[model samples]
Target: MKYRLFGILAVLFFLAWQTLDGMVEGDWGRLEGGLANLSIFFKESMWPPNWSVLEARSYPVCEQDIEFFCSVGYLGMMETLKIAFVSTILGFIGAICLSSLAARNLMPLYISLPVRIFLSGVRSLPSLIWAILFVIVIGFGPLSGVLAMTFYTVGYLGKLQYEVFEGMPSEPLEAGRAMGLSKPSIVANIVIPENGNHLLSQLMFMFEYNVRHGTVIGIVGAGGIGYYISTYLKFLQYDKVFALLLLIFVVVVIIDLLSLMVRSFVNEEGDVRKPTWLNTLLKAKRSKASLVESE
Candidate 1:
């Protein structure tokens, strides 16, 4: 234990030293100067937030003679949503197909082992790195972002789904086999229905994650909100940047609420219980009503 602790500390110290050396080589003094004026910088950049950017009318309209017209921020946001939505759907489908073969309980060792390894290899790299590679190969655009997100999603959702499949009770499989059901029929009719809610939950979570990733990939010219963010930051337009950030936050919150509602519905019983907090409140209300009736 003593030697292990010493090794860990030594590794940490070496990492810290490397970080400091890189900072020094990259002119750490500039960062220190910026930190010293951080308050001033925030005051100048974020004060009197120009919320007019959020108003649709604030966007410029092209002349009637012009062939096209669009708001940059609005279009960028929509594009980001599109990239996330499309990629997530494609990824979920791919994950579902691969997961059946990947599940150890559902497939032979030779088949499942290779599938698991392939998924692990795909997941080893971050989505940003994948986006960069796709950008180089496919050229900069939403296509690159879509492909990157899809690949990452497959690696991610595949692992989760296969585990879920593998963990399923053996009773159902045994019963299905006794009934002479084929493997494909057993999986489709029995396993899928049993785990429908979990699969949907995973897909929703992945969609939320992909939305955030979509924005980051756009920074590399994948053509989404990140592209607009990069452009605004380059021009030092912090107001617009903040506006876009706010829009993203709002959208993410909406998605979260929607997912919560859907999950609640999927898990609902006779009562409309959902969102644990709300369920508790409803239970309290019912208790109060029962006491009043008894009185």
Candidate 2:
């Protein structure tokens, strides 16, 4: 019976995959003919990069404008970081609250289903579209970026946290209630601690995701490194565009490495060696006054 079920599933998977593949191929056929036009397009606009800006030749094409772009580029990136970090913090908190209510063992279908639908709606809209909406509502610049990042973070974290909640054990939850603990108390003492690492890991993951989203949101005038890169491309400043690409790559790689460290710290809590300073912060803050008062 198991073998038959597996064979049927495998055949269905293959057919479904091919059906989607054929649909994509049909669309690609329409664009494939125009693919060669890119070469012709580039040939018509021969824009050489200002590589000499680093040294001689005195590439004096809009020195003031270049300076402004460089400054604004960094500022825009900083604004993006601000938006991403702030949105992630608020969104992660909101997700936790929603997840507690979304968990099947914890909440009713009427509640969880609506929340799930809401999250789907949030994630369904592309970041660019979100930015456009925000621009209409909040006006342009970093405000739009913040709103877009906020929704994205909510969708991503709520989806992830709900999964964590679903995987949670029932034994402790039942035991807590048997002991007459309130639901909130049970969640705080049992669920939150048990899933702290997972929550933090998701927060970090969302941080990285929103960082990339920040850069892209700026293309819609939401403000980020993309603003500079796009402007440079508009003016045919290939070198500046290339510089933005390199810088974004480095920033993303660094953030990825930081995320890996955070994940390792969370997952390897039992195996990690002791630290002097970094480890001290993780030690639960205990008040001597409380201990003395209790004594």
Q: Please provide TM-scores, in order, for all candidate models, with all chains considered together.
A: 0.77, 0.72
What tens-digit string does per-residue lDDT give for candidate 2 at 165-260?
789999998899899998788778998888988998788888888888787887778877667667777897766566556666767777876675
Each candidate structure's count of clashing pairs? 0, 0
In model 2, the worst 10-residue window by lDDT is: 51-60
TM-score for candidate 2, residues paired by index? 0.72
Q: Per-model C-alpha lDDT, please?
A: 0.83, 0.73
- lDDT string for model 1 (138-211, tens) is 89999999999999999999999999999999899889989999878988998888888889999999999998
Off by over 4 Å in 1: 1-38, 55-69, 268-295
Q: Top TM-score: which candidate number?
A: 1
